[model samples]
Target: MAPVDRVDHNVLERTSLQTRLSEDTNTPEEQLKDIIQDLYQIMVQVSTYDSAGRSSREVLINEIKTLSESLRTLHTSASPPNNLPSVPPELLEYVEHGRNPDIYTREFVELVRRGNQLMRGKLNAFGTFRDILAENMTTAMPELRDDVVQVVEATGGVPPGRRNGEQSQSQPQQNGANSNHASSSAA
Candidate 1:
């Protein structure tokens, strides 16, 4: 039995092709034709060797098949419409790396928007609470109404009795705190 010689055909072909292709001044189509011819010649040369050349034959066949499929695909894809506009690198970079807007549900976005609007129209607790306190003080001590109004005005608060273009109202007939206190005392 003869010893099967194991050879690395890729190393040999790569060295030869690298030298020849580098010096060739042919057009791309001519270069591709030359490659196919060269591969065919190599396939024929490998057949003359013994069974030791089986791997090289398979490698060369697979390479030819791959190159043929690639050439076909390239021919089909090469003629894409020229009207397609090219994306600028800056815009692409911004899209890739910038802080992007979050994707939220339309309902959630609308809810937030409405909440913002309602918040914008909310009553100022400082003025509202101050007005309520001043009104309560005036009711409990009717003689202090003018002084309360003066204090409210000095502090930039709207007196409860004089809000919304209404005139300063007279003190309430029944004070809320006094009525509650009297009811509790009786109980």
Candidate 2:
């Protein structure tokens, strides 16, 4: 088979597998909802048992039987698909504490975004420091100027004093220098 055809076939297979897995994951949740609805109906029938009279007893009994069957289906469906991801303990704990899981997810996402922003700030600070240090060291030791330039270019850093447009202009030079350095180093 052609390489392109093989890749398409593999992609189709993966899509099919994911579709099946998602359906499997939802099956138990759907079953549980069905069981809950059945219970609610049975409760309603029992509550109106006296008003419903003799016929109510038969309806209540039928509802109870349906509820029993739903419970059995739920029991069987509760076995999760083998490849399904397990619930995180922290999420389970949050729910057990009576908090909404959606709130927990939002809070967790916000926490991660804050952490990422903090780390990004740190990384920017370090990059700025690297550029300033490189500029100063180049001035202090003219003999090491070439090596400093190489390091700065290889790291895709903007040299001190280069701003927006100038920074963009330097990118191609930096990329070329970086690739050359990478190839030479590999050799």
Candidate 3:
């Protein structure tokens, strides 16, 4: 489908027949896969709450509850067994807790079903970071954290990590024109 602006990602091009066909005309199985990806992105990335330190801590906890409820729904009807397996280790537990039923809940289920889109975004981030980090990691004082991050990035079922060392995001744009500029120069 040719996206109507708000419906698509920020790609600066027309929808190719291939893209439109793939995105628009997925099989039920494919659509289910896409939803799970979406759930992971939302829960892991966007599902955050801010507190000024005087508000309810329970608010964030409840939000996580809502997310779990949605995921439980998506798990049954849509997600693959591996990620949101039809037979999740927690299914009986969810039922006992009265979170989600066998039937799908649109609010929770839909996002979990959208795995393809979510996974792709994460993968692209990994590749971008990989290029930056691989160029910068050193022999004498290698960052142990970076290696751990790469392991996490490799898991599509979870989330990916940054290849670039921890720096203000603004630093990247400032050095966007240079591929091999070390962090010290940018500082």
Clash-forming residue pairs, model 1: none
TM-score of each: 0.26, 0.42, 0.19
Evaluated against the true structure, the overall lDDT of model 1 is 0.58
Candidate 2 vs 3: which has more lDDT: 2
Compose the digit string of candidate 3's lDDT tens values, residues 117-154.
Answer: 79988887775566455434422224554563455456
Q: Which candidate gets the maximum lDDT versus the true structure?
A: 2
For residues 61-116, what per-residue lDDT tens digits would candidate 2 score against the true structure? Answer: 66666667666666666766665787888999988999899988998899999999
Candidate 1 lDDT by residue in tens digits, 70-163: 4554455444666468664555665678634342245458979999877765645556567667768877887897899799999887654554
lDDT-sorted candidate list, best first: 2, 1, 3
lDDT-wise, the better of 1 and 2 is 2
Where does candidate 1 have its weakest 10-residue lDDT segment? 99-108
The better candidate by TM-score, 1 or 3, is 1
Give model 3's TM-score versus the native structure. 0.19
lDDT of 2 at 185: 57
Q: Each candidate's lDDT (Cα)?
A: 0.58, 0.63, 0.45
